[model samples]
Target: MTFVITRPCCNDASCVSVCPVNCIHPTPEEPEFRTAEMLYIDPETCIDCGACVDACPVGAIFPDDELAEEDEPYLRLNADYYLDHEVDAGEPKPVRTPKLPEGEVHVAVVGAGPAAFYATEELVRHPSVHVDMFDRLPTPYGLVRAGVAPDHSATKSVERTFSSTARKKNFQYCLGVTVGEDITHDELTERYHAVVYASGASTDKRLGVDGESLPGSVAATDFVAWYNGHPDHADDAFDFSSARAVIVGNGNVALDVARILLTDPDDLASTDIAEHALDALRSSAVREVVILGRRSIADGAYTNSEFLSMRLVDGVDVVIDADDLELGDELARQVSEGSVDSTIGSKVRLAREYADHGAQGADKRFVFRYLTAPTRILGEDRVTGVRVVRNTFDADAGRIVPTEETSDIATGLVIRSIGYRGVAVDGLPFDDAAGVVPNDAGRVVGDDGVHVPGHYVAGWLKRGASGGIGTNRFCGQETASSLIADIIAGSLPAPTGSRDDVAGLLASRGVEPIDSTGWAAIDKAERDAGRASGRPRRKIVTVDGLRAAAGG
Candidate 1:
């Protein structure tokens, strides 16, 4: 049997280059690669070299026979992709590492997340290129550490790859240093040949409804950051006293919040979730979480992998009303005929399955309400309920239109998980509508559409908040390529200042940037603490605590 690409697939295409028989589909060269949730292996390709198993950074590949019970579905899912598309199974192409110019090049990257690390990985490949990565947080791996669900350890395993890049001789990290405050953009440009901003979307998109600012109404990003122990939201509090929680969007983030709220505290206790968040979850009275979507199920933003994962949660019932899905006879016919997109077909099938299989009367329940939009959050001081209006998916118009039907969902909390928006950098040109830095293929663009000299962007900051962890690899590489192209063209000039000069300037500013050694200390301390508790590393949720763990 062929190996299966499981849910943790980062879609970085690392396995594609290493596959001996080219079994993995949606290669970087394929158009489907851009939208594919995860790469799949063709079951018909039988050499079974197992090379991808070692090449995958996230440990997503497993032999069909070796697959865990929870992941058994992926075996069939991998083969299903081949049913629709023909498998080429061509010879693997040789991997190529780009050669760099001879002159020494130093680039400063703002943000120590996956994007920055991936970009650094590209640049540091050349012995002549040096990278200095900066982040305001004392820690690195921005969203990987602060946004990913703590229970998704396989996804978090990608930190190992980032750590490898950190160990590169030419790379350096300047943590806990604010760019606009401690050092200006001009200062960074003066100190390096180029500066690449990878600081991702830090803020959430608002619902723009009345009573949204109420105490119990919060953004899903805040909840994610809070549970993941982000220092900025470490002290944030949530009232889980209400039995029902209403989520304004039906995205993966909403599912994550619902699962965490309804999950057995014992299951989460072993994760790296924040101590305070864990304590709050343990005492939570929330038993039912209603996820509202303004559009039909076919237009759902969440991947089928995440939607199906809800079924695996023990002691939790996934409730989906068949009528709410709005799956007309035509859509069902398309799904049955295999004419619809495979991703959408799987999602619709899974949703119908959930709807058909009535709830087993589990203690906790996650309900999906589609074609519903929240008009207002109802409460005097805090969230009491959400006034939502039912919408009809005007398939002919390809838009959702409001109907006369309106109802109130009784709940203590309302979480808007609509989406994330990037914050504008103080010195960079920002696209207010897109919530991204205006850029053309990773090169920063000004208001006049001219490229900003020695300035570049990667990740969500460049393209808006889209794609997943592995998507950043190519995104960062594109920015790095732009920087390289600038370097080759002699457009990027050598720095006037040196690293020592920058260090002295930071010292003068009283900004004690945490070095790699200090971060290692903090990591080790957390792991050691977690080992004592028989859990993964207990996260240091506060900035002061992280700094203290890093030996100040």
Candidate 2:
């Protein structure tokens, strides 16, 4: 019997400590763990201990008997880990908790994203710790509120957890606070025992193609932010009057953009969509969305669950080329037979349904165009079309190779959903290539091989852009452990200034950080304003609006 790790693992390695037989290889303590997407349970070890299943918070581990037909490949993947290594079926390592002193320790976390919230929650577990969290926008939950598709209400529920954490007395919520521009990192470090940089990846990875700078062309990240009422994108405009639109990547984000555009305007209006964006969408003439992928559909970036959700959306036709539906291997054949519940099977079923009933005259259609790479945007002042080249799959090289053969697709707007990259924070060491701060576990690394004591990272900044909400829990645990270790080691700095002193310093510098009460007032005003607007809860989508609503 074998056990396999699925997509939900998030590289957190909680399973590593729980496997009683030590069959789970590449624990986070191991050098290779950072590079592994998920943990693997060696099938040949024959211990069959279910300790890992109990440890995984997200339920990523599965026994051989429980493995769905689609997950059978993971059985082989897990077995392969032991092909060249000595098997270790020894006793599991014990779980360790942080040790802290008796006094309260003040900490400042920059960014109101999931990482920051989780880190603060973990820190507060040490009864003697207090957290002051700051964000540039008045609202919190960086990506949950801004980047996630508004239609994904289930994922949006993460905000509830964050809200609950913010209610803690030791945790302070400071909105409308920008670190470098409003307050310096040096000042934060000076005022708190430790400072954590959880500011998530803010910028989109641009598609460096000609005409990408056109007015109608936009990054999917920015578009998501605009529709989701992110303050930064409040004034941004999206043109959907064109019959057709083109998306450059085939990630879950691309699927999100496509679904939002293709969804019924009436359905969207009832949700928490921004009033302005919803109004624009109601009048949108968009009929077709072409999702361009450099590789075959088999290697698309979106997960099975996301694709399934896209297919389940009402009043939208998911179109795909019939030729592309040909199963190339045994796994694909199994997927086609419905013997598997894998991601590809979900997408294949949707594609087959759409192809059977052609979407030529449908109200809205999302078409998946495989083996196509965007060469350039075609337009003068606004996006009018896209030039695409044929691509050949290089199985050996594990990448899609673009060919010279080209085609043109008419489109009114272009959205690139390539990926996200982290940015350098002031007074922190950042890796330009990896788009991460150099860190060992949670300890921020600096030149001369010295660790920046009391500074830490979690979530995407520490592990890159991957995993879901639950992923942050373990990431936060690791960072918190490191923090407690530092405190126990007497390496953490003592808070030099009082709360009033920090506030006075900020006021002197013309920067005002919103207190918890102010955030509550802003929250109330938004809910009231949303009630008036006849939506679930309309957000004050601008910094000025939030400030005004908060009576700042």
Candidate 3:
């Protein structure tokens, strides 16, 4: 029997590399990888070598006969992917590890997130190279724990892969430490040959509207972090008691917020949503959510898979206005001229279908309003409503130009989910406009048009905040390759000594680093607490709590 990829895929795509015969659909190379809820295996092309089963970090794959009774639908899901789509059973390429230097290599990776883990994985492939990862949080796997929507449990399972990466030989984790604060750039440069910064975009783009600072108005990033139990946002509060909430963006984050606000609290009992957030959602008076997008379907950042995913939310209904679903002449021309793929067409079709078939007596609903930009949040102290202007697409300028027409959506809460931008690193050169560290490929670029010696970047910090988890794999490889090439060229000077010296130095400086073993204890504590409540893992949202759980 063939294997099926179940819900916990998390879209890491590690399985694709290990399979001798490629059977997974919507690989990272394809557009489908962006929004696919989870990757599906083509049962028709399955040789059952069991490589995918082993590579899957979340244990999402199972032999057709071995699937639990509740997961029987996934068997069909896997088979159905093949029924409608073409399969390419291409042979796998030979596994290649980077050529390394003779002696031991030491690298310090700032930010113990997906990109850092992927880079760590790449570095450890060479037996001589060792990696010491640093992060501000006591926990590892940065945004996988704090940014991803908790209801999307499958997406969060990528942490399992990272946990495995932490166990590799010569791998070290120094949690609850900020690089610029606890350890300076000069210190790291003196201690290691190279440093790879995977520090993610920590802030969200503003709505740029007046009254955005109203108590009822919040950034989607903060809201996301708050709901996911991030320590930084642990004490943040939201006015979910509002009857209707308005979201001023239509990306995946907007969709996630709408889904979470409207979802039945009973469903989240099995998920890992923060306890306070869970209570907030359960007590929420919100029943209708309005998601506003300034751009048309053709230019929107979210993909077809995400649009389709919205329709699958249990009990919640999607409301697509007929006018919004109707594509403009410019968008239609772009689609016909092949400027964009059929993905937009698929999204337009789904919108039309939902518009045609209105909400079927569902208590909760989400209304998607396109081509509208928020002008201001209407409020005195807290948000009372939002004023928006009709936006006309300026194809020539490739921007949305505001029209004279203005309107208002009455709601107590307004959430801006426009986008995210990275925080500035102390010594790293940052391009403020792009909100990323200036880099050519993966090498950090300085104002003098020279590569920053022994400095590199990967993930969102290298590029602006975009792409999924697997996207970091390629990015990490490129940065790792560059670092390796630099080492071979003898450009990057080695550290004075090994990690023992560095460890002692940290101790003398009063920096108490949390090692991988301590992290494992924290993991067990979280899981154990979650088991008591029949949930995934009850997250530790405070620094003290996490440290205690980590046995600090």
Candidate 4:
């Protein structure tokens, strides 16, 4: 391979559009892209034109001759994706445009993240269907702006597509508008033909042990938001006075947190990380991050591409304990039997290589601990350490079982990155068990399995929190199908009011809706501020700051 795509590929898929050969698998149009940790350039078909090298925003692509020794494995990782599938013979058929309603229609989409944006983009395909988007924050593009790691600038580029969707004629944005607080479900239902909810999962999974709320313990959700400048967590502080930190989950979120912690402060200076987080990192004492996996190496949830990417960051040395990498007979048999796919098997194989060689050490160390579970977080006012019990892989049972052995790791900070869950919407029937709106397909259904007329959902609210950006396309399409079916069947409720009336209602409540033009001012101000600092963009992290910047 003369060229390769490596660890810094943040799934933006920009390179796919640039490549003349279209060798990248799961080009965001394919289903696998949603679940993939990162994109890979298929070694079998790449023409070595090196168009990807210039297109990669994070500098993730490089000719094989210039590949970092730590990232040499990606040459195989990229090739591995095509092992089970045939290479594309030619360009894929252009994506099919969604069939939208034929006449003037008004829809209210509550949220302005990727899911809502995707749904909105589809709704506006019909020139006559106008969409009004409402989000709680003055700024939109929920996670893209405030949840993605600052270093992953490529992924943020997807927002430009959303901006185009927003600018579509007749589309309106009502930022700083809170659902249920300022306007109730009944109010939206009365004014619009259909109401769609795309508010993403907002809460983090809990460790559910003692001292979880200690000053030193935090959620990866807040940590990410704090660094990426989420308004709700802009003032939050993390304890970095200790030399060692413990992250309780081994998923991609944990990987992202680890990368941010170990990346050199100077490297973050030109990124969009909030000033507060950058300042805290500059004065930090943390040198080691221990990511604890509750399952065996074969069961690790993070993608192999992410595992390889972490090694390429300049300051961190990542090590996997030698004993943990051993496939332990059963998993090895599965790999040999072809019961286990190569994408997953690669993690165990390459992890063993890191365990065998990466321990020489560097300025910072990132270590992985498999088959370990934290039984309790030990301490009172602050997290002093965690008490963990050894877990044995019960291959037949397909679960991790507790053993008599125990271990204690002394650490000042513990960050939980288990998962994310959605909160209940006031009027919608929510399945607390799944943290999702009770739905059949895309139509919001009640607990008794009866459809809630005109109510629909997309993205994390429709499904659980999982998958990446591409996943939302599936959801947006499904919800659009359901809503369009209802509209065609004449089953949708007739709107009792007009756009003027809805605007009048907001005026009566003294709520000023920020339109697309106002949002442009905020975007411009943030970029102008970034220009002064020589960064990509400087985020406004307060609701007041956002309002002022938007010329409110």
Cα RMSD to the true fold for all candidates: 1.4, 6.1, 3.7, 3.1
Computed on alpha carbons, the lDDT of every model, listed in order, comes to 0.88, 0.76, 0.81, 0.83
Model 1 TM-score, all chains together: 0.97
Off by over 4 Å in 2: 1-97, 325-361, 395-398, 495-500, 532-534
TM-score against native, each model: 0.97, 0.81, 0.89, 0.91
- What is the C-alpha lDDT profile of model 2 across 211-304, one tens digit per residue? 9999998999899988998877788888888999899897878988998898997888767888889888888888889998877776677765
Q: Model 3, range 1-552, lDDT digits (tens) per residue?
A: 898876556677889888877888777667666556567888778898999988887677899999776567566556655554675789866666657658877899999878888888878878788899999899898888887787777677777778777888789898888788777888898888888999889888997779999899989999989889999888998987788999988787888888888888888768899998998888899989999988876556764456766777788888877876535667777656645444565566567778999888888898998888898899897899999888876767866788899988889989899888998899888889999999887889999989988899999999888876767766777688888888778888767655567667778888788998889999899999999999978988899999998887
Error of 2 at 37 (Å): 11
Q: What does candidate 1's lDDT look like per residue over 182-256, in tens digits?
A: 999989988888999999998899999999999999999999999999988988999999999998887778888
User: In model 3, where do residues sit more than 4 Å from their true spots?
Assistant: 1-11, 21-54, 58-89, 333-340, 394-399, 496-498
lDDT of 4 by residue, 445-535 (tens): 9878899888999999999998766567557767877877787777888788775677678778987778888899999999999999999
Lowest-sum lDDT 10-residue window in model 1:
327-336
Clashes of 1: 0
* Descending-TM-score candidate ranking: 1, 4, 3, 2
- TM-score-better candidate, 1 vs 4: 1
Q: Which residue runs of candidate 1 sit more than 4 Å off their true CA positions? A: 328-332
